[model samples]
Target: AQSVAQPEDQVNVAEGNPLTVKCTYSVSGNPYLFWYVQYPNRGLQFLLKYITGDNLVKGSYGFEAEFNKSQTSFHLKKPSALVSDSALYFCAVRDNVGSARQLTFGSGTQLTVLP
Candidate 1:
């Protein structure tokens, strides 16, 4: 089984300040992690992924995530946040060796960047 957790239900940040959205996972064998963002009335947009190789993965809209094997975490980060960056963020995980082809997603974290 694969599961993901976004501990924070909501995250608030001031414009131009650094922002982070935390994610942690548990899975059998190796894990494939991903981040997605959803705006108002919009579908999920692919932000980034950690399939293999690098521990640090970069994604769209200046977002990046660090894959920490020891912590089983993939925390999303941005050096500076924008008001437009406010949206719902989701963390997902999939078992690399499993027949289950679906990715398990977290409940989602609402990010509000105040100007």
Candidate 2:
């Protein structure tokens, strides 16, 4: 079975400091990975994704992720945190399974940024 786990329930970060939200995934075949962020009472916004390119992929809002094949992980990172960046984050994966079209989300990580 393919799955994703976000180990942290919440991450508190100070503004202007580095931030990281951890994610680990398991898949039977090649994995199409994505990172989406959701603000309170809003839809999920696409932050970044790793399809079939470089391990180091960059996307919206100065965010980036690295795909680790051996570790089976793709962790989201930012050089500096902002108060506006505080939101709920989710890591999702889709594989070659028949029932895997929709994203299976993690429990979610609530990110809090202090000014």
Candidate 3:
């Protein structure tokens, strides 16, 4: 079985400050990790992924994530946050050596960028 966890239910950051949304995962095999963001009344938008290669992956809206295999963690980061960045963030994982193609997602973390 594969699972993801976002320990923090809410993350508050002031505008123009750096922000982070933490995520950890457990899986049977090598994990394919992903990050997605959802705005109010909108579907989840793909943020970044960690499949292989570099430990750091960059994505849309000036976001990036670092994959630490030793720690089984993939934490999302942004150098500077915007009020518009406020959204529900999800961390997901898929087992690389499984028949299950579906991704198991975290409970979700609501990020609020205060102005």
Clashes of each: 0, 0, 0
Q: Write the per-residue lDDT of candidate 3 for residues 1-115, one digit (tens) a residue.
A: 9999999999999999999999999999999999999999999999999999999999998999999999999999999999999999999999988688999999999999999
Clashing pairs in 1: none
Cα lDDT for residue 10, model 3? 99
Across 68-89, the per-residue lDDT of candidate 1 in tens digits comes to 9999999999999999999999
Model 3: number of clashes? 0
Worst 10 residues of 2 by lDDT: 96-105
Stretches of model 3 off by over 4 angstroms after superposition:
none
Model 3 TM-score is: 0.98
Question: Per-model C-alpha lDDT, please?
Answer: 0.96, 0.91, 0.96
Candidate 2 deviant stretches above 4 angstroms: 97-99
Cα misplacement distance, residue 72 of candidate 3 (Å): 0.6
lDDT of prediction 1: 0.96
Ranking, TM-score, top scorer first: 3, 1, 2
Specify the poorest-scoring 10-residue window by lDDT in model 3. Answer: 96-105
